[model samples]
Target: MFDVAGLWHGFQIAATPVNLMWGLIGCALGTAVGVLPGLGPAATIALLLPISMKMGSPVTAIILMSGIFYGAMYGGSTTSILLKIPGEAASVVTCIDGYEMAKSGRAGAALGVAAIGSFIAGTIGLIGLTMMAPPLAEAALKFGPSEYFSLTVLGLLLATYLTGESALKGLTMAIVGLILGCMGLDPLSGAVRFDFGVADLQSNLDFVTLAMGLFGVGEILYSLEKSGTASILTTRIENVFPKLADLTRSGWSMVRGSVIGFLVGILPGGGAVLSSLISYAVEKKASKHPEEFGHGAIEGVAGPESANNAAASSSFIPLLTLGIPGNASTAMIFAALLIHGITPGPFLLKEHADVFWGVVASMYIGNVMLLILNLPLIGIWVQLLRVPYSFLAPLIMVLTLVGVYSVNNNVFDIWVMLVMGVFGYVARKLKFDLGPLLLAFVLGPIMERSLRQALLMSNGDGSVFFTRPISGSLMAIAIAFVLYNLWAARKKNRAARAVASSEAAK
Candidate 1:
């Protein structure tokens, strides 16, 4: 299923001057966003949706977008090492040992290990993607409406269980997202639903508008509340190359992180952030000197950094093959495809092989580009960190406003974005996980259409989902996950009550 000829052709497409220029731009912008605290790749991609779409070439646009995805994983470690600030959520663990290493005069070594590990891990993940995606897409071609419906159900359930601490809250958010997804014209009947006499609501609430509001403006508002002084280490970095001994010690850690990251990244909600956290824990558990963790251990920085980048690389699998966006960044990429009238699914490889292979090849090039940028351009990122958040925040707001307005040229969409921004701000303050919400929102219409079509085919029989072999297996798995989540939640609640009673007695 892996085609050498196709890969070579992809490289040819990716290596063109125009594609290379856009890819470089995306990598640079991604790195800058990663080095900045408030801006994220998801939000940046969402903000740039209009601009990328206007380029009129989906392959070039996706190559640029994919570069930003993995490039952020590399750039995130800079602030973690230098200032104890995580520029990206996935880099949070790096702040522990990375900052400690900086204080211990090993900042350059830490950064070096992180960059090298990321490159290696990204390569590993890319290899996995190259091998796995085509076969999976072939298999998915056999999926019918029942199978599709069941798969979406399984995805939503897994996302609810894996992405959030509270399954109830996650499910609640997912339900809300489903309702929102239904708030437009019915795809099959073209009958207006949930418009409530508002004309803008008839066509449908814009996904780009909602995404920009929730991620871009919402993050800015939240960051404003928590803005404070960042303590930058004055330690001068020297020798960015790791010692041979250190490399030997961290070699297995990077490999383990790569494997872990790639496997986990295939899961619906287990993205770069979750993969990095899991990798750090695994490294800590596997290390002989576990106590050295959080106190300048090189493995601490190596494993998580590698894992995050690997996860970023692998997360595109579902988006390309199954048309399922595994994380927010990929979800934005999914939106980009839709903007170009390209539906991402089983037939995408057959129809748009250029977009698929070109993006993958570009990722290979982008990973190398990031390694070079991170190693030699540390000072550039450090200088970027000095730009006041005050200035950056307002500038982001203006961009958000301008970008959202440019979408449909409707002032009503701007108001919708502001309302969603407030909702996102409140959701964050209340500790609600937004991942499931967004994922459900994206999957809702798909699920609805699949279910309706399945019912029509079955002549209104619901058992068709359980009667088919593939759909039956998927439905069974979804049921198992739901039961497991409920049982786990119950156990957790019981434990919390027991601890509370014991403390009260004491």
Candidate 2:
């Protein structure tokens, strides 16, 4: 379904020296941040959104941002292997076997396999994106307001289910986001709802305020609170390439991980974290010598690394095709496109073919660049962790200030950022998962508009959502999900009660 000629044209744009330079810079920066603990791609992208806007075209801006994203995916394993600390949630699984490998003098080999696996998975994801996104987008064009509304509802449901140990917490955070979304003027009546007499509230809170403050500033504050003693890795060896036997054994793991990651990432709330975990679980289950899993198993390193990178790449599909972000990072990407005066939807491919395909083409080049950089410059990425947190913290804070101020030179916005940062910090301590909240905040406005449009078209007929074929199907799925979760919760409660009863009888 993809336009071959248009894709080729996009490569012509992405292959240019200027764009390539941007990609390299983004990769370098992304790698640096990815090696550091407590910094993630979402926060990094939020921090860079201001700079991306200043770039000439939407295509160039997106190319640079995409580079940062996948680069982080490639770089995150460095800390996981060397420091026994994951650079992000997704790298947590890598820590189990990766660090073990490092401790056993295969650090270089583990890093090499990770880089190679990530490249293969990224390529697989890109192919899936190229083939699937166009068809999915074409299908989405037929959706009416009701269908779109159902789709958003399903997205929220899936997100809640996939994140955190508690569904209740995810639902609570989503509701919080919905409430915050209502703080601005009503889209339909133009009547102020929750402004509380603040002039900025009338215009509603801009996304940058929420994203930067919540993800960026809040993260820093939380990290500072828990700034434990650092541990340094003193063990290392020379060769960075994997043996032929390692590659032979890990080839299937990489292939399977890529497939799993691509599928998971397309789902709402599914990102590298979940994909890597699932991949590891699958590898363990399928391995004949599952006992070797936590003892420097090559499969352990290959699968999850591949899965993480693949997930990162495929997560872009929803945002690029249907204007729906599958995760927090893509939500930021969605916001970036909107800020650039380019609204993404089913029509995006037809309207902005250059930007869409250019970003895709750039991923191919970016993946290759990352693979090359990651292998030879592995030493450089490890050294980044040596920089003191004290030095980095102030720089990030200063950047946050500059970024918020650059938006409109508004002092009020800076205050808003600080306020939201506090809110986010408190929320994190309270055990609320910010993933659902941030995504819901971004999707909330779109959902409200679609629902209102549907009602208007149906003359206030609430049944319109349940009567339309596609919308009905989606509604059914959402209802089914609710029922399934309820059943699971109830079953767990019953099991706990039975155990208590047994203890009492004894």
Candidate 3:
């Protein structure tokens, strides 16, 4: 049950003129960060941490910081839909069908659905936070190493659905990603693994660098070869909002994404990126027209966008209730709280009800503001599609390079990005899917660490995953899904063979 009295008090604090202005400012900055590739919310918050200390009021500072966090979730889809560049790691899945929709002149619909879906999910997730934060945080604590390992395994298996038709190619890319993920020092032992004698390689590859290279620079290179102009202009802009048909198609997807994102976000390490990927996989698997997934499916844009936003909202649960930041962005917030002489934990609600409830109240307001702000901006973003690729290409390359370098201020990252961009271009030409590679790269470290921890805890027992109840259940589900996919592929192959035989007889 929700505390109506406490929530009302929260609204009082959030509705003050000073807090509102800061919230708006945070929202604007977050949107800018999301529109630009490579700059992430975590870095932005960390940059602003010193300024937050001067604010004097912890509640106001937190409201501003929280605003930026969720607002980025609303803005990330813009670049993905318009330019096929993922504005944030969580927005990577949006690039698949969102870019396709842009090419088909349905950019407006995709943007509209993403914004609306985000609003819906944000609202739903906040409500869940208000009503179920304590219980959910406790549930999240139940996820041990075995459970986390099983979960990552399930996520890896789901990566096959995100790529080329051939499971072999998807698995190969996943394995390659795992290898790439292992390029730095080992987690358990500080020994270097695959640094290739480079000092920079000793520190793991930056995900922002990799993402900007693979999507932004790679897209530019591919466009230079494939088409000299923007393909989107071939199809005229239809509307700035989603049509009734699109809304109908995406309604249930938004709801489902909200549920999945909130639940996943409660668990440690399950941040917006992971939730978005899981949401995309769920939508693809649930769709009646599964073949249409990678090709302008509105559900694809709607579900993942909704999910990431929901995850953004729900991710605060661990930080607030358990004093454990689930992701880097939340870790920054945890630091900010500490700087203000406020410790977040079980007694936080009793000791600092104002901070807890004030943040939650502001999130509700931020979601509304984000929806309004993002909707009008869709038309402006769509205009970029009118620019010729020849003229736009250099600008994109500069932004990609700048964004990649900004993350770590390292020139070596730029060189690495250039190499990865060339690799991405060559991979695209070879009909290879980059989605599984990125997904696996993100999950690989978590999976390895969890597997090692679980094994250590179980005295090197390999069957420990099957022995634990939660891990056992998740592992069983993964096995069943894999078997089902194999059976489906074999059935399809047999049907194709029969058709070939019939044509020969004819």
For each candidate in turn, give its C-alpha RMSD to the true structure in angstroms.
1.2, 1.3, 7.7
TM-score of each: 0.98, 0.98, 0.63
For candidate 3, give the lDDT: 0.79
- Candidate 2 regions exceeding 4 Å error are 501-506
Candidate 1, residue 99: CA error in Å?
Answer: 1.5
lDDT of 1 by residue, 1-506 (tens): 67888788899999999999999999988989898877889888988887886897999888888878788888899988998889888999999999999999999999999999999999999999988999999999999999999998988888877777778788898898888888888988899999989888998778889888898888889989977657677898777888998899999999999999998998888889889999999999999999999899999999999999889988988889999888878888998999998999888989999988898899988888888888887778878888889888888888889898898888998999899898988998887877787888889899999999999999999999999999999999999888887888789889999999999999
- Model 2 worst lDDT run, 10 consecutive residues: 228-237
Order of all candidates by TM-score, from best down to worst?
Answer: 1, 2, 3
Error of 3 at 39 (Å): 14
Please write out the lDDT profile of model 3 over residues 47-111, one tens digit for every residue.
46546767979999998888888888887898888778887778999999998998987888888
Residue 333 in model 1: shift from native, Å?
0.4
- Please give the distance, in angstroms, between residue 385's alpha carbon in candidate 1 and its true position after superposition: 0.5
Model 2 C-alpha lDDT versus the unseen true structure:
0.88
**Number of clashes in every candidate structure?**
0, 0, 0
